[model samples]
Structure formats: structure tokens, C-alpha cells
Target: IRVTVTAIPIPMACSPAFEGKSIRKEEMYAEFGGGRSPAFELLRVRPEAEVEDGKVTVIGPEIETIPEGSAAPLGIVIEVAGKTMKKEYEPVLERRIHNFVNYGEGSWHVAQRDLIWVRLSKEAVKNGVRVEHIGKLLASKFRIDFPDLLDAVQVTLITDPEQVLTAKKEAEAIYDERDARIKGMKDDDADTFYSCTLCQTFAPDHVCVITPERPGLCGAISWLDGKIAYEISPAGANQPVQKGGLISAENGEFEGVNRFVRKASHGAIERCQLYNFMEYPMTACGCFEVIALVLPEVNGIMVVNREYKGETPSGMSFSTLAGTIGGGVQTPGFAGISKSYILSDRFLQAEGGIDRLVWMPSVLKEELASRLKERLKAQGKGDLFEKIADERNAETIEALTEFLAGVDHPALTMDSIL
Candidate 1:
């Protein structure tokens, strides 16, 4: 069924750009909630020229600009199929914040993706939306009409005075809930997982899948958000394909999983078999921060780094290929790894091994380091623990080259080691 939703801008609340310079009609890198970043265009604009006693009627595309260096702010009325409709707001902010981070000033992005539904059926109701809370979220409001006439709808709005605090608080609350749930999981429990998988386009070989019990290492999407996404589109941006059973080990290969991986990646990840330290095994995302290669002369392996900030072995920047990896199908058994996942050795090592993770966040590195120690203690390999936790230096463009230049362990560097 075709559904239409109207986006009404709340007065003096949502901001779209920095200073008075509004984003023109151009497609740019944007994200919605934790979904993969999508290209967003400036469909239209409505400007509010007058405000009396907090009541404003913003005409099409012209809100007064905030002072210099302030966020581009405004309210809007999004029309869909002529009727007032209910819609989701989280994705809008997610996309906007992502644009700001990658294109705008430093890392200040809005956080909340949860938007309460508003019904907009009649004209009066639709007009009331301009003053309602949902509109306030986007800095505009509306009521829905013919609520039963549609299945779903989402509208995006550009606001003035970006509502970062409200969104951040909501995002944090969701994260806290996720942390609580995962704390109750056993060491080796399998459950449905969620991730951005989109990020792989940029961080290939790095698979980041998050379960209800585990938060993503990047701390982006939460379990609650994942559940909402699944609800929104079971087959589109929201659903996850589950992994079942094990792969057979023949010639160090798992036929079932290997077949699945090849089919999913269209044969891009052909070498992925049953082992972790094997060459060209299925990378979570085509984009990898580092590629672990075995150097026969050194009797060890070295890592070719991607996503590093400095000079790489090939003198390429992380941004050069960050788009190749995270946004598509990953290993067969694993769901897409776009946004979040636990920082565990089992998950990390499944690709190549720890030597590749020198570039992850400090928090994740430390968490993994501590967890590895515990696991090592269990297996009595504690003496061999080298505490490879260098937040500032691990994944630098230089370090990745160094990893590939030196080798300490063959098994650790092999493309697949069952």
C-alpha cells in the first residue's frame, strides 16, 4: 500500500547547516538512525519569517538564519499524497548528523532516532502538528488523516537550532538499556544479531555485529533501535538473515558456509573457508582496515592497513576505500555487520586475527585486551599476552605498514586457520 506522511517543521528548533549557508540541492552523504548512510537531497525548503508568542507560520523555504557559526535552523511541512500522515523522525536526524560529521564541523551530531508517531488526517489536525511535539522534534508539527489508508511513511526535515541534547539523552537511555540486557548473557550464547553492515563499505574485513546482549564497539546503534528497524522493513533496511549450523572442514574449507558466502558476495570473498587465519577468507566488509599477509622470508605475517590516518604501504588513505566494505552481505553465518558488535576475540579472529585490530577505538582495544587476558588465563597462555592495546598508534597508517613488514606468528597472520 502507498503511504504518505507530511513533514511539518517546528518553530525555532531544528537546525540544518552551519552559519547561514544552507545546503543547496545536491545529493550528499547522509545516514538515518543506525542504517547505512544514504544519499539525501534537499527536496524543498519552507521558511518561517514571523513568530509571535511562540506561534509561527513558516512559508515555503525561508526561515531567518541564525547568527554566524550557529547551526542552520528552520521548520518545515512535508506533504505526502495530500493527507496528513504519521511518520518516523529518528532516521531524519541520523542522516542529518552524519552529514554534519563527515561534511560539517567536528563530531557534534544529533543522537535520537525515536520519533513518536503523530496522526494527521484533517487540515485542522495537520495545522496543529506545526505546534505539536513531533513537529517540535523536527521543529514542525502535524496530525494525521486517513490513518488506516496507509502502511507506513517517513519524512525528513531541516531544522534551526539542532536539538542535540534531547536526541543525545534519548540515545543514551537506549544504550543503557542495551548494556543491561547484554550483561546477562552467557559466554557463548548465540542469538539474532544486528549491525550497520553499511560501515563495512569503509571498514571491510572488520565485521561488527551487535546482539541484544552486546553493544557495538562503535557505540552507534542500540538493541532497541535494531528492533525498530526490523519492524519498519523486514526485508529492506531492517531485517537480518540468521546463521545456522557449521561448515564442513575439508582441505581447510567449510563447503556449506563457503558456498553461502560466495553467493552472498557474488564471489568477491571466494577464499573464505572454515579457517580464520586463511588468505582472502570472507571479509565482513570488502573494506578492511588491514590485510594480514604471510611473509615466508620472515616466517610470520604482516598486515596491510586500510582506514589508517597516515601513509599506508601503498600510500592510500582510509577514505579512499572505506566505501568498499561495510554496506553489504558479510560471512554467511553472520548477519550484516554495519553498525555494532561485541569486541571479542572469537568475532575478531574469525576474519584473520588480532594483529588487524590495532586500529579500533581505545575503549574497544582495552576491552578486547582485558577479555583476551581472561581467555588466555583460562587456557594458561597468560604468559604470552603482549597487551596489544595502542589506542593512538595501533591502526595508524604507519602501523599497518609495519604489521605487514614484520611477522611474529604464522597462525595469527594466515588468511584462514581452522
Candidate 2:
């Protein structure tokens, strides 16, 4: 199909896409192509380009120059290989979900037109493209071209399309199948599991263990995924460590994960672990603020925030040096992070008891939130007890770091703290 598209920059356009007559960020979609090889071309436009009746009256920003920043707007022009058609269209919600499944998370944020784009044509609409089919097409046609996006791009064929009625149902089925085997496992209550240790580079001395019942503070990965990742690599993504036997006198004691923390931190952090969020404790989640550390020549301790783009206080990039401090192991790279695992025992701990918990993101946490809340309240601290909550992001990570830095409450560490 022969098509031309563009992205338009708009100051008052309000809506990000055609679907959002009001909100600029919303997107609208349509289908094209099913016939022989179709010719296609892409063009970019500015946000102010008039799209009133569907005919391109004015041009917007240049396709290549379309700024990646949030303030800029873009327009995509699609011309069929044979016909001229333009109309405001609403995309099914499933389309976005499929995007996530095939692309993992935040596919659009990092995606460029070269990765995927619309190929409008008369036959495309006639075929009535389904998200599953699109995902497969991406996987078969474009997945390899973007190797960095394969896992994130959850491309899968819908063997039985009829069963998919809603996005929620689709998500449920996918997760159910993935989590079926990990329904029951246990971690020592004192172990304090978490997946937010990845944030150590960004928010030092803060660890957020993701449990089967609770997601990470960043709301990124679910415990089930974490568990699977753990199974894939035991010593790599995260390592299980003892917490109870720690010899704590004030804040400078604790064994197991604590010793691991000191080594991981290169002796930068003095004493602390998941359970004791007090001074120089477990590192923050990957999505956190203020990375704390004990740098050579630096007096006392040094803290780095999300914006401290300069050399890290640890003499390592926050991204690379983070794994070394969080889960009792030192990881040199960030690519293996998504592959980290979660174990049943991490959440179903029975010894010492758990005080605080942390994790990434997952629906399983939502389903089991109430039960975890009850468990926390039963251990006293009912006044401090709220509910088993989940959070994920770069900003809230600072809060998590702060919490672990001072809170001495008995914590339950997870199997995959990193």
C-alpha cells in the first residue's frame, strides 16, 4: 500500500492522537492491507496541522525531527496504495494490551517508526485486523529487526480469537497460565523478599522485596514473573540469604544479606538489610530516587537522586553498580534485571516474621492485597499497618529508600530482592 504519514507538534492541540478529541495523548487506529505487496510512505506532521475533515490541509513537524519529549506533538499520514480514506477511528483497547504483551512495558515510549508503522490500503480494512494477528505479524516480520524489544514485545497468535472478549479477560488468561505453577511456595519471614533492589544504583540503601501477594514499590513486574526469572538464574538475578541470624546491636549488625550488602556495596555501606530499613540498609528499587552510599574520601555518607547524572557516589554508574548492593549479590549490568525471579517461600515466610515488604508490579498483588494486610496487622504495628500496597516508578523510589533507611520494623525479605 502507498501511504504517507507525519507527526504534528501542537501547543493547544490538547489531544495526542486522533481518537482523543480532547486529550492529546489518546490514540485512534484503523487497519489497511491484505492484498499483494503494497507501496507505503511515511511523513511527519506538527501538532497544529489541521485534520478537521480527514484531508491534510497543513503539514506539521518533520518526521525525523519529531521531538521525543512530552511537550512535542506528532501527526502520521496514511495513504492507501489504491484508495483515499480518512476518518476519525477508535482503536479497541485490546490493541494496546497486545502492544504491552508483545512489547513488555513502555513499548511506545522507546519505539520509533522504523520499529513499526501503519501500512494503509483498501484490503487492510476489509481484512479487519485483530490485535493477535498484528502481534504475530510484528513477531514474524519485525521482531528480529528490533532484537532489544523481543521479550518486551509479547507477540502471540490467538489460536482461538473468539474467546477474547475483553482486554481484562485476555490479561487474566495470560497471567493465569503463567502463574498457575507458582501458586504455593514459601520464604522465611525473616528473609524479606524484594525485587526493587534494582533501584540501588538510583536509591542506595533501600530494598523492596516483591512477594507473591505484593508487587514492587514501582509497580513494574509481578511476583510470578519474578519467580520465573529466579528459576531461570539463581545466582544471577537474585540470591536467597538468611536474615534472622544477623548479629545486630543497634544498626551495625546482621548477617546473611547484611554481609552480602557490605560486599556488594564494596564496604561502602556499613550495616543494614531488608528487615532493618535503618542507616545504610538495603538499596532502593531500580525505580527510586536518592542513591545512598559510603564513598571513599567522602565524609559520613553520600546520597544521589535521580538527577545526579554525574559520576555516582559509588564510583560506578547508578545503573551498573546497583545490583551489587540490593539482593545480597552484585550485578554489573541491567539487562538481566527483567529475568530476575521470585520464590513462594519469599512471601509465605514462617520464621522471625515479616514487617515491611516491597516488589515490582503484578495483578496477583492486587488479588492478594487484603490477605497480606491482615498478616501485617496480626504482627502488631496495627497503627502503622495499612494494607499490603504496591508501587513502582522513579519518583516514589526515594520514599522507599527513606523508609528502609530508618524503619527498624522486622521485615520479610523476598527471594528476589534485586
Candidate 3:
């Protein structure tokens, strides 16, 4: 017997607030990922001959078959082929899937890369929407958004438990390889960086110049992402910023960046030091993954991510701290950065590097454990991770200072950050 659910027309314009809106457990018809089961989204550049234009395949159960209030494993693999398509563009396109999927009238999507959570509304199912509709939505949206760079697009949706697990593993490997390739790339290695004005809709003066070492504050766009974005739409938000001259190698100040920031911010920001938080740090647009604040009492910096709702050593919650630093203001001693940048060799090089990090939320520390360990080993401070304190160890400034003293944290012996 054929079953038909009602279908609602996709919205032409999606509200920005809808992107962050979450679906509670009680409200969702079906949930995916969110640490419940294996799930991932992968995008790949394929040879022209290997792709069938506009084809979307569903390997397992369709949306209507999923039990209400059930959590299911999900794997989304998108393949695109075009003369101009490059491997560097895969992640950029993959990231767009989140936004495109959210454009659906009754669907909600959050997060990106391997950590994704999605919910299909019962209203959508009642409208006769199926899993294949998501594939079509993505394929159509990509063509509309990147017409010049994509000649064909195909999407594969997997829900079978065994298949989801296998695809997730493969996606993880691909993700690691892509990350390694991007990590090997350095800012100075390129003659041009890219500017992202995507957040300008919310903060008009904010302009983010993304580099290999410094990804966007939102933790979404990388250097390669910016590059492809410029290639596809030269006049778009992502524009190429020629690296004209170097002002300070130690602090990562550049003549081109200074000029770009002044023009982009309409003269509100006169100067910016890319790798330093103590000087004229880059202005934040409010979507930053983490905020690094100077903790003068401990002579170090405490990192707080958006997910941390508790009080920080700075005696401020993440929201309160973000308000003080964000909105296109050149707030000295406060820098907004991507989580991956925390692992880079260029992470706050002028501000004493990782040695200056004193405290972070336990979840943030655990998330970066492997990377932090590797970076520490490279710096010949493999034991420093142990020396750093988390929320569990210190919640107040005094408590953090005492904890650092007890641990003999190197920041205590370093030059005063104040």
C-alpha cells in the first residue's frame, strides 16, 4: 500500500533565528546524532564521469517509516562533479548543507562537520515529506548557490544502523585527512587571504579575514573555504585580500589586513594584530566559538566556549563576556577564535602561546585533549596540560590563582600578561 503524508512548500527565505532554535526531546518526531547514535555528513568532489546529475538516493528507511520520538542513525554523503570543483571546496559545500536543510519549512538543523543534530517535525511528515526530500533540497540549493562551480550534484541518505556506522567511520577518516591538509597550510605560505562578511547582516562593521592559521570566529569557514567562496562569486561576501606587506612577524600584523579592516569596519577599527590578544585584537562578530579573556590576577588567559554556561575565572558567564568583547569593537585583551585555531602553532604566539592558557571549561578541555596533547609535546611541554586548571578545579579568580600556584603552572612564571 502506498502512503502519502502532507507536504509543505519550502520557505524561500529562512529566518536567522531559526538556525539556532532547538527542538526539545518532547517536540521532535525523529532525532539524529546529538551524541545519541552514529551520524555524520560528508561531501566529496568527484570526476565528471562518476556523477549522475541531480540524482538523490535513499539507502534505508524513509522519513514516514521512522517511529515518532525515535532517534535514528544518519549518514549524509554528497558528491559533486564539475570542471572547477576541487577537493578544497568539499568542506565548504558540506557546511552549506546545514543551512540549506534548515530552509525546509518544518525541519531544524544545528551544528556541522561530524557533530550534527537534526529534527524532522511531525508537521513535515504529515505534509508527505520524506528523507529523499532532504536530498533534493540540498542538491537544488547547492546548484542555486554555486552554479558556476557545480555541474552535477548527488546526495545519499543512509539510515540503516550498520550502514550508518560504516559510513560514519569513513566520513571521520575523510574529515581527519581534510583537517591535516588544512593544518599543514600556513598564513605566510599564501599571498592572499579572504574576507568573510557573511556575519555583516547582524553586525554591519564586522569583517572576518580568514587565514590558514586563523579560521573564522564562527568556526565554520577556513582558508580553503574562503578561497573557493571567492572563486565561485568574486563579488560575494568572501573576497580576496592581497597580502601587501608584513608589519610585525611576531604579532602577525599585516598592511593589507590593516587596510581591509579599516575599510570593512568603516574606520571603527584602525588596527588589528592577528595572533595577539593583548594588543589591538581582531573585532568579533558575536558568532565566535570561544572567547579568550585576560586573567591578570593569574597572569594568564582563561578560555570560555559558547557552550559553557557557568561562571568563568573572569567572573563572567560566556554570554556576558561575549557582550563586552563582540560587536565589531577592538577590545584589547579579548580575542574571539575558532576551536581549531587553539591547536595551531600560531595560536596567540605573541601572548606567550599555550603557556598563557590557565583555565577552560572541562568540556572544552576534553574536546581538545588529543590536539592539546600533541601541541604540548611539540612545544616540549607535554606535562603542561596537567598544569592547566578547568572549572572543576577553579571557579573563581582567587581559586584559579591558588590552583595555578599549586600546579606550578608555567603562566605564573611567564611575563605578566597585564
Off by over 4 Å in 3: 1-39, 48-50, 58-73, 105-110, 117-131, 159-165, 201-204, 218-220, 245-248, 266-268, 285-287, 304-333, 361-367, 395-399
Model 3 global lDDT (CA atoms, 0 to 1): 0.81
> What residue runs in model 1 are displaced by over 4 Å at the alpha carbon?
1-176, 183-236, 240-245, 248-317, 321-342, 350-386, 389-418
Q: How much does candidate 2 score in TM-score?
A: 0.33
lDDT of 1: 0.34
Give one digit per residue, the lDDT tens place, for model 1 in 1-418: 2223233332222223321222221221111221122112111112222221123333222222322222232222333221221123233223232322222211122222231111112232223323233323322221132233222323334332244234345445543444444444532354344433334323433443344533333344444445555564455233343434444332234444444445545455554432344444335443232333333332333333222244323333333433333344333322222222323334344444433332333433353466556666765656434433233444443554454344342333454323
Tell me, by TM-score, which candidate is best.
Answer: 3
Clashes of each: 75, 97, 6
In angstroms, how far off is 366's CA in candidate 3?
A: 4.8
| Per-residue lDDT over 47-118 for candidate 3, one digit per residue giving the tens place of the 0 to 100 score | 998888778899888877888888888898899999988888887778778767766656676556666777
Clashes of 2: 97
Residue 85 Cα positional deviation in candidate 2, in Å, after optimal superposition: 44
| Total clashes in model 3, counting residue pairs 3 or more apart in sequence or in different chains | 6
Q: Compared with the true structure, what per-residue lDDT tens digits does model 2 show for residues 183-256?
A: 44433333544343433432444444454543443333345445434453344334443444657533324466
Ranking by lDDT: 3, 1, 2
TM-scores of all predicted structures: 0.43, 0.33, 0.79
Candidate 1 displacement at residue 45 in angstroms: 30
